[model samples]
Target: MDNRFNFSVPDICDDHADKVQVSNLRLQSFGGNDTFSGPIETINCPDDNSLVKEILNTPGKNRVLVIDAKGVSHASMVGDQIAAKAESNNWNGIVVNGYVRDTEVLKTIPLGIYAIGSIPKKTDKHGLGSIGNDVFVGGILIQSGNWLYIDSNGWVIAKNELKF
Candidate 1:
């Protein structure tokens, strides 16, 4: 899809032309907030076992899944396995403000996952988390029912559906 009309947080914040800066070989793209305007479904989990199943069942045909991992450093919140599930389910993408595992594998999938870093350890399955709620990360308000736009440049959120 042509991203020229798409709004990128990084470029907008920099007062530069709307241009998406593609990353290098799955490298960090400087992590920017994507503007989103739609229904918000928050998934707060440390492991993919529970979240993965829920993600697979999610009806995100054209919506985004914002996951709040509580910025946990113990383990990864999302990974390639869950990403694959999301892709197969036709989800727009996943935004994890926490850590993710299996970068190499995740890159292979078309899931748009934004996270802090990668971890080698997986999360423990305890079936603990909240779905369909508001979540805040990096002091950014990610309320339910908001539109989130993401790209190679960065991410941004809009209170309502925006036109570029």
Candidate 2:
């Protein structure tokens, strides 16, 4: 009945490669936690962070929020305040498919934050984008409720929590 994932990404690849889907994007670590794992929550928000903000307001329940920002380089879907809110709400991790702002502050947060890069441009809050949707990025198809595991090596997703 234990759901804790203490296994490393490399070990998972070596032992359970066929059972997990790995992300091709080389996401930079921006949070205090280098290793984290939990069920996935998806957001397809590009150029706007309304959905991101909205979701972060709710209880995370130890879930990881996967955001598909369309790899937008100009606008950041996450920032210091948003990330802090997520941490305060108990989100296990956040994997951004786009850029983020406040790099230094993001690193202090106690969670896993993997993003393509950083930018100073903040996104608009148009309340646009869909939640609980499939996010395709870096040759991986991420859906809500999928389990995501991140370690110092990299990230890997599975349909359910892996027990090792």
Candidate 3:
């Protein structure tokens, strides 16, 4: 599980121009690994990360968690513990549509974490959130099982897996 995904977003786009959806959001990278690719898994955790923790605890071999925090920054939905679990369970990466805490530890984990920003506050853990739901980020609709390619240049969404 050592950054198993290896591919370039720009190269993939050039080859699959008609099959990709590029995101406009400029999310910051906090994890050690900068690039990753995997099948998508959606979550809706607006102001709460209970379900986020739940999902990361499960097996995540070659999958990415796409969290829809309703584009909010007041409450952090993903932090070190949750992200650590993700890396431990072999998750390729995480794309949070909200903020994340533990900026320091997050940068050390060997997982890909792209977030809007970082905060110091954690979620209330009210167990509020939905799983396997479709999420919208950067005006692009991302559904479960969709392929995602993320790198330093940017992230790209494809309806299906593309050959690198």
Candidate 4:
């Protein structure tokens, strides 16, 4: 595999399209961990937890989960259970534009999980939402097929994978 876009790990998306393409006001990379890359899988929902199960059950070998958490400041979209599931399922990483819980446990998992912040609150198990669809986050348009690169520096997206 050529891994065309396999350039230097630290790169920036200079292309601007109206929206800024990042929204979680306080969530930041756990540290300088450059642990996520690859195609995007989006989830745009509120109070829905079924998709979390679906994605966890599926194979995420090298895929990144791009979650549109609707900026739920009061609740956490994921926690220890979800993170453990993702790790067991081989998910490369999870990027949530919302809150998450069990921060201490998450730091121990091998999987990469990025979120807006950690809250003790949890979400409703409505099992309601759509997967593998288009979503607008970070002030940018992000579809299922788009490529996303996430690291401690922040996240950058593009219609197609960018090559160096």
Per-model lDDT: 0.60, 0.89, 0.90, 0.70
TM value for model 2: 0.95
**Model 3 vs. true fold: TM:** 0.95
Best by lDDT: 3
Per-residue CA lDDT of candidate 1, range 60-154, in tens?
66567777776676787766767777767766666776677787777767556677677878878777777766777556667666666566555
lDDT of 4 at 140: 74
Q: List the residue pairs that clash in candidate 3.
A: none
**lDDT, candidate 4, 17-91, per-residue tens:** 322254333356531234566778888876666687678778876777888888777888788888888878867
RMSD of each: 5.9, 1.6, 1.8, 3.7
Any residue pairs clashing in model 4, and if so which? 21-138, 22-138, 27-116
List TM-scores for all candidates, in order: 0.74, 0.95, 0.95, 0.82
Tens-digit lDDT track of model 2 for 11-107: 8888888899888888888887878899999999999999999999899999999999999999888899999999999999899999988999999
lDDT for 159 (candidate 4): 68
- Count of steric clashes across candidates, in order: 21, 0, 0, 3
User: Candidate 1's C-alpha lDDT?
Assistant: 0.60
At residue 91, what lDDT does model 4 achieve?
Answer: 73
lDDT at residue 94 of model 3 (Cα atoms)? 95
Task: Provide the lDDT at 5 for model 1.
Answer: 32
Ranking according to lDDT, highest score first: 3, 2, 4, 1
lDDT accuracy of residue 143 in candidate 2: 89
